[model samples]
Target: MEITRSRDFTAERAWGAKDIANMNGITTRLHWTDQPYRWHVNDGEEVFVVLDGQVEMRYRSPEGERSQLLEVGDIFFASVGTEHIACPIGEARVLVVEKEGSV
Candidate 1:
């Protein structure tokens, strides 16, 4: 068995991640960031979970651009081809699950 403590995780750069596991074709990762990620669409569905701190999740909808504040324990789900970006309020840790090699 493996154990991980999100509080102890850090990265030298924003969006740096540690691979946690791969089951079937899906991948699970723990990420650390203090900066915003560029707007883009994932190749597949994405599940984002805030493990610590807060984040502002921005996305484009048919109506227009929109954003939501994601606090600790909050979860964000992005369907495939959904354009979105994640901006951290400060230093934050996030757990992400998606298809392997997805961007």
Candidate 2:
């Protein structure tokens, strides 16, 4: 077995998300100003915690896009292999927790 102590990790960024990881999972911090971000389908699911502000999550489909607004302390999950996007309703920060997989 392996244990990763809290002090051993650092943050990294890419494609609008800041991330950290251990053997079991990936954690991300996403920040938004006024710009929206778009995401494509991938293999894993993502769970999000709204940490400091508000955001709008948009899920794309064949007919149209559906959206949900998340405020501070709100939690939501994205299904595995779905296309989606998000934007700040206000200056926002989100904590994303996900398993180790392609998504």
lDDT of 2 by residue, 1-103 (tens): 4443322232343224544454455645443344566666656887877776678888877778888988878987878766887776745666677765544
Model 2: lDDT equals 0.63
TM-score of each: 0.98, 0.64
Work out candidate 2's RMSD over C-alphas.
5.5
In model 1, where do residues sit more than 4 Å from their true spots?
A: none
lDDT of 1: 0.97
lDDT of each: 0.97, 0.63
Question: Highest lDDT: which candidate?
Answer: 1
Model 1 lDDT tens row, 23-65: 9999999999999999999999999999999999999999999
- By TM-score, how accurate is candidate 2? 0.64
- Tell me, what's the RMSD of every candidate? 0.5, 5.5
